[model samples]
Target: MFAPTFNLNLTLRRAVLAALLAAGSSVAMADPLHYHVEIDTSQFSGAGFLDFAFLAGNSPAPGATATLSQFSGAFGALDSKEGNVSGSAPGTLVFGNGGGYNDWFQNVSLGGRFAFDIVFGGDFLGTNGNVGTTFSLGLLDQSASAYLGNPNGNLLQFDLMPLNGALPASIAASTYASIASISAVPEASEWMMLTGGLALIGFALRRRRVAALTA
Candidate 1:
């Protein structure tokens, strides 16, 4: 009688709910990816400008290609080859004297949360005391300039230091290399929101399915 029909409706509604839940769970979002960046400068000259200057494709040199890592200020990764790279010579360095290198810009893209870590070796600081001459790693906003010493744009410079005894003859010249470990995770609230949205959608879909079946 009515009891059998009622039980049928209840079972159908439960089945619909289970189906919707399964669908939503299948589409559940995942954690963002973490990109670890390591820059290999051994092959390239110890000079940042030399490395930056001749970075394969953009360099005046022909048919060159280098792998560059990048990060976005928020929810993205920085690409070395894609983001703009530049620097200034303190007039004391051997290879980069008289502005030997021109800064180049590379556009990069990434997904999810982003940040950068930097590493350095003794060569970067060189045998000069001007260890203050820094290598930068960060996302440059549109307003930033690729030129040396612009001082007006948003750029993150990672200061370089020399290794111990790297310059036995000239202790003043300290050098270093850079390696960065990056970690990016989605915002907790964002994850919660995504889960909640999925849950709500699942509930609605199940209810609709049950209603249609019953009708």
Candidate 2:
């Protein structure tokens, strides 16, 4: 009788462990966030690179950022004056960060028809003055095929601030006077965790059944 009771206790403990894993996975998966934004640099033309960083509330120093190797994601496309930020339309590519030189694009394309997406670990916003809340996009003069993420050559740029605490739906999205951050979505990490947790649970259940039958 005690043998049966012992087995049952072990099974119950395994079930609890599986539940904890699911909870832990959910927490681990929730930090990554996505923001959709848009801009048009067609106003000017030349070359430049993205020159911005996550910053503290009002400080110039670099703020906290994602620990993952994939620190950031920039997806966009646009038409420009001297040249263009190339992409296949309806805009779904790892957008480059270049365009005009003297800031003509900034003047004209501040609030216009443009689109892009920002992705990073949301937890980074919790500290370092909520640095992750700050976001930036720019077109800096580059002599050749304009690439993404080489900041400093800012021709045109866009930014949003004080958003680290939380990302509200629609409200905070459009608070910026310039580009509009439209929507949000979950990518991969969350799904991956849920799948893994479910697999563990299934494995545990199978083992418990096999043990009971053999006993």
Candidate 3:
């Protein structure tokens, strides 16, 4: 009788262990956060349209780096300028006129709002300043493929200053002015797996209790 009871307990323990492992794996499958950017050019005044823009950081004196890509929409077909940057520095890729230099007139218009998305796998909080990072926008003319300035060599830039106060200890996955951030949540499948694991653990406990009572 002792041998049978010992075996029953061992089996139940193993079931509980397996369920815990499954739940652990489910929690580990969360995705990274996504940051969104929206630029309003309706009030922007230039001979040609607002072709492209560059985003870079300035705080923590080179805080974080990221990759910028243009998502599908009105400006998707314009050109693809994707590259990496480091610590508030600028990355490669021209946002207007196929990255060609000296073609400002052919630039895209910012008469309304221009929006895009970027991803950064780094911390936003700064160690040296209240606002860890300050992002600046550089707008180039259609005639200029270069990022810093237009063909006439004039630099049109906009700075997205950091928050007035200290950076938040934690930011929720949501939208903000000119920028939006989203963090990964568990998928339905992951949630289901976790729930199933929990159920299995409960069932194992119930079975063990039944066996003990019978004994």
The TM-score values for the models, in the order shown, are: 0.25, 0.34, 0.31
Model 1 lDDT at residue 37: 35
Tens digits of per-residue lDDT for model 3, 4-111 = 567667766776676676555532313232345555545544433333333333333223433545542234223333333222112223221112121212245445
Per-model CA lDDT versus the true structure = 0.32, 0.37, 0.40
User: Mind sharing the TM-score for model 1?
Assistant: 0.25
Candidate 2 on 1-215: residue-level lDDT in tens?
Answer: 12364665576676666656644553342433465554443443444333332222343322323111121223233333222122232323222212222111221222124454555433233333332133334444454344322333322222333233454211133332232234454456645655665676676667667667776
The ten-residue window of minimal lDDT in model 2 covers 102-111
Displacement of the residue 107 alpha carbon in candidate 2, Å? 16
Looking at candidate 3, what is the lDDT of residue 173? 34
Q: Rank all candidate structures by their lDDT, best first, as comma-separated numbers.
A: 3, 2, 1
Please give the lDDT score at residue 113 for candidate 3.
Answer: 56
User: Which parts of model 1 are misplaced by more than 4 Å?
Assistant: 1-99, 102-104, 109-112, 124-128, 138-151, 163-215
Winning model by TM-score: 2
Clashes of each: 36, 15, 11
Candidate 1, RMSD to the unseen true structure? 18.4
TM-score for candidate 2, please give it: 0.34
